[model samples]
Target: MTDDLDTPVLDNHLHLDPRHGRGIDAVEDFVHLGGTHLLVVNKPSWHLGVEPDEPADFRPVFEETIDAVDAATEVLPGRAWPVLGVHPGLISRLVDERGFEPEAARDLMQGGLEVASEFVADGEALALKSGRPHYEVSDAVWDASNAVTRRAFELGAALDCAVQLHTEATEDLTDLAAVAEEVGLDPATVVKHYAEGRLAGVTPSVMSEKDRLERAAESGEPFLMETDFVDDPEKPGMVLGPKTVPRRVRWLVENGHDEAVRRAHVETPAAVYGIDTEATLE
Candidate 1:
């Protein structure tokens, strides 16, 4: 393939789970394919079905995520960043005492993310004492998560690294913006890929994407477009064919949407990942 993405070609979302072909093979492939850095996200212990009922027993997922990133950075030299978090897939658990009822969290086994709290303590606290888990957005939870995001952002700033996040629902994106702002993060600091499925209420490819794109444009926040994943045709999707970015870049050269596209796919991500915009995509 062409080194079109060689400019930075960073994939923020990747897994270490062997079942999804995520382990070393995945890392090797990404490096081979020109991924300068990968944000490796990890999960909590409960998902493996072996854990203490106590929140105190579980470690913050970020700890492991950081470890993974550190290891990758050492091994890859200039590739692999760690994205730390618990997915909101556990909305039920946090909001209801009946949270972990049989089959309640079973959905997590399949790419679920609602479990990890930005604040490991909060998620664990809720997990242990949440009398009535409510899936609806909780200010307390958001606040706690915001704090954790800030810590992570500050950590990134210290190392000049990018922070990967779980951006699912409209609320999730809202949280992302809030946390980014709270952490004094430039929109470009967030590296998101395949993070859509989080928003349950917002139907895919619906009216939200236009709003997202418009927001990205207005804020000069560059977002990403990944290929090979599902997209909601109703929205503006970033996933382009291997040729999509080039074609779109060519199209923009020959058409409009250049300013917006440049900000979203190029400027934003490049700035966040510390890549040179003029470095040449290939």
Candidate 2:
């Protein structure tokens, strides 16, 4: 499986939780199946047992993500870049578990994003991650989550990097694109993680399922491919497996979707994240 393809196979969103999951071994699974690159995203702070009272508290979470990226780069066949930020669902935790007001929760998330942005600025990470809750929430909490997402967009604009979003599953992402535009960030650089298909205005990091991959590939528009591999030991392959993207890329190629492979794995990621996918593959 690893010998047939010459083009880069990049997974746009993945997580590595060494304390609780397969960690670098999961990354090895990806590379062994022919994946050439990864955008290793940060898990939620609470997942890492970090309770943030202020911005500086997010450092350890971001550092953990960076460390995972470094470890993957050190031992894996492909490259791994860090994407760090506050998980949108953290707003719910802050309000419900931490006893923070909605507005205060939003502020703390924004501050956490600020710290994540500094990592991008310092070249420790490639992009910033942010989004609203994927489940039902109070209107105020939803508003706060959006505010935090907007702050992420602002930071992405300042750093000239990509922003990976983890929002509710939706077919239309025109509203998210509008927010990116309002924040002076290019909508093309706003990636909808766990995306099902090609969105109208925003970049879709389509999940590597046959149906979704077929739909996005058939669209012929620039898009990215991801597994959203949570890498949790208990749930083991909760969202998707690490080898899914590379395997899907092979499927696309066999189905004569070479252009889609180039667009999703090479062109789109390079344009959005400013990484030389071809060079990295070499």
Candidate 3:
């Protein structure tokens, strides 16, 4: 593959946990491989050693995420931005393991998202991250998770920021788009993280797999690329490695997919996140 470093490569969804992962060192690895930008999302609350009993409890979790972004920025300059919110899987954890009622669990998650919105309002973060669990759950828990997601959409609409989603694997996102429409949020700004292919509705931050990258490149769709690197030291490279995005971009360009590179790495991200990817390069 080509080793050109001119293209602005952005990892749309990534995490840096200093407590349990390589943290800033992992970000350095990504940058060394030609990555240029990142949307550093928050890890789960429990992962940060915080068990939220109220809305304010999420503050520490979000603060840690912002801190990580700050650290990454010091390493990569203005190329990293934070996307904070309550992880939707928290609903199941609250209901099943933490002995919380479904409705109460939903309220807690919504409240946590409200706290996260304040961060976006203060310009500490670029976008909000929220979505339903990617696994099967009881109907009550499912409904509660949807409510929390809708609250996130409302918050995003008010802040005029994108909402990165983490949900079940699906090619069709029409139903989720409907939810965003009902909440009066732009469906185009709702990014599907870990997306495998061209989703029917909403923006797709396609995961950096060789086949998926090739398909997204061949389709010529306006999409973004991400590694979704968990950065967990225990399970290193569990989701995808941090270097995957830039490496995939090189592969695409060498395979005569320059247009896809421009769109995925620059155009689409600028359109969705309202940030100049090229500016960071200069």
The candidate maximizing TM-score is: 2
| Candidate 1 lDDT | 0.40
Clash pairs, model 3 backbone: none
lDDT of 1 at 243: 27
- The TM-score values for the models, in the order shown, are 0.47, 0.97, 0.97
Clashes of 1: 28
Per-residue CA lDDT of candidate 1, range 1-282, in tens? 334532444343444543222345445545554444444555434453334344333344444545555555554425554444444444435435545533333323211222333323242211110111124445654444444445554544444455554433343454455555565655345544443323221111111233343444444334553332112233224343222333333333344555755554446546655544334322
| Candidate 2: stretches off by over 4 Å | none
**True-structure lDDT of candidate 3:** 0.88
Q: What TM value does model 1 have?
A: 0.47
Candidates 2 and 3 compared: the better one by TM-score is 2
Model 3 CA deviation exceeding 4 Å by range:
1-3
lDDT of 3 by residue, 18-100 (tens): 87889989988888888788999999888888899999999998998888888888887347899999988898789988999
Q: Which is superior by lDDT, 1 or 2? A: 2
Q: Candidate 1, which ten residues in sequence have the lowest lDDT sum?
A: 124-133
